[model samples]
Target: MPTISMFYGILVSMYALDIDKHHLPHIHVRYNEFKTVIAIPDGEVLEGRLPIRQSKLIQAWVELHRDELMADWFLAASGQTPFKIDPLR
Candidate 1:
């Protein structure tokens, strides 16, 4: 997994050639011990859990960078390194 962005103690990443689970454009988020897979298009939690505050932050970040995320997803699915996205400020 390669980290694509980080903000407010949240780490966002994408795995290259990842397709078996969460077969959609998504991101893996981690904040402290909590982690979750979130769908990129809708900011829905596809797996795992996070604090409500962290979850909201993730959704807002996703919404702010949906296009970049989708592009990264395509690159990652094809086993290419994804471009780093700007962190939420």
Candidate 2:
């Protein structure tokens, strides 16, 4: 997993050629011991959990970077390393 962004201790990544899980454009999030798979472009929680505050921040960041995220997803799903995205400030 390659982290594309990190903010407030949250690490966000997308696996290259990942398709078995989620089966859609998504992101993997890690914060402390919590983890989550969040759907892209829509900000849906596909699986797992994160802290409430962190979850809200993730949603907002997703919304702000939806376009870039989708672009990165395309590259990632095709087995290319995704570009780093700006973290929520």
Candidate 3:
């Protein structure tokens, strides 16, 4: 997995394997021992679980970075830019 961004202590990453399967723009949130996949464009939860507090923080972060997130997703999928997302709001 390649980290796309970091926000509120959560590392946002995306995996090539994930793209091969899901084929959708998305990012993963990692905090402590928790990890959750967040679908881009719509900010939907795709997999795993996150604590309530962490989830709220990620939700806010995702909403604020929706545009950048999508851009990162495209760049990652297309192998244009290294998988690195912009900072959180």
Candidate 4:
């Protein structure tokens, strides 16, 4: 798994796997016992479950670091150096 970003110990990561014969541009968010994927760029939750508060936090993080997340996802998919998003935003 590649880590795209981190916020308050919550990690946004991605893994390369063929889903239905096509590679999807999505990333996973892991916090506590929560694990889920939110589609890149749009920040749409696709899998697993996150509580409302946690979900909001994830959304804000994704929005503030959209560029880094996308770049990291690409890098991870291409086997390049996985990028870490700045938590400065």
Candidate 5:
């Protein structure tokens, strides 16, 4: 997994050549002991869980960067390194 952004203790990452398991564009997020997978297109919780405040932040950030996230997903699915996206601010 490659971390593309971080903010407010949240680390956001995407895995290369990872499209079969979750079967959709998504991101892996970590905050201390909390971890979750969030869908890139709609910020849905694909797996695991996060604190409510952190979840809300992730959703807002996802909405702000959906296009870039999708692009990164395609690149990662092809086994290419994804470009880093700006952290939520």
Candidate 6:
């Protein structure tokens, strides 16, 4: 997994050649002990959990960077390194 961004205590990442399990364009997020997978197109939680405030922040970040995220998804699906995205600030 390659970390694409980090902010506040949250770390966002994606795995190269990953697609089948989740079956969607998504990113993995980790905040302390909480970890989750968030789908890109709709910002839905595909797995795990996060604190409510952190979850909302991640959703907002996804909405703000959907296009960039999708592009990164494509690169990752093809087993290429994804470009770093701007962290939420």
Evaluated against the true structure, the overall lDDT of model 5 is: 0.94
How well does model 2 score by local distance difference test? 0.95
CA lDDT, every prediction?
Answer: 0.93, 0.95, 0.76, 0.72, 0.94, 0.96
lDDT of 4: 0.72
Candidate 2 residue lDDT tens string, 1-89: 99999999999999999988689899999999999999996899999999999999999999999999999999998999999999999
Number of the predicted model whose lDDT against the real structure is largest? 6
Q: RMSD, each candidate, Å?
A: 0.6, 0.6, 2.0, 2.5, 0.6, 0.5
Superposed by TM-score, candidate 2 places the C-alpha of residue 66 at a distance from the truth, in angstroms, of 0.3
Question: Residue by residue across 10-87, what tens digits does model 3's lDDT show?
Answer: 887776535776667877788999988888777788889899988887788778878877766766777665446566
Global CA lDDT computed for model 6: 0.96
Name the top TM-score candidate: 6
Per-residue CA lDDT of model 1 for 3-80, tens digit only, reads 999999999999999989878888999999998999998888899999998888888889999999999999999999
For candidate 6, the per-residue lDDT at 53 reads 97
Residue 23, candidate 3: alpha-carbon lDDT: 69
For candidate 4, the per-residue lDDT at 27 reads 75
lDDT by residue (tens digit), candidate 5, 1-89 = 89999999999999999888999899999999999999887788999999999999999999999999999999999999999999999
lDDT of 6 by residue, 1-89 (tens): 89999999999999999998999999999999999999999998999999999999999999999999999999999999999999999
Instruction: Give the TM-score (vs. native) of candidate 1.
Output: 0.97
RMSD of 4: 2.5
Candidate 5 segments exceeding 4 Å error: none
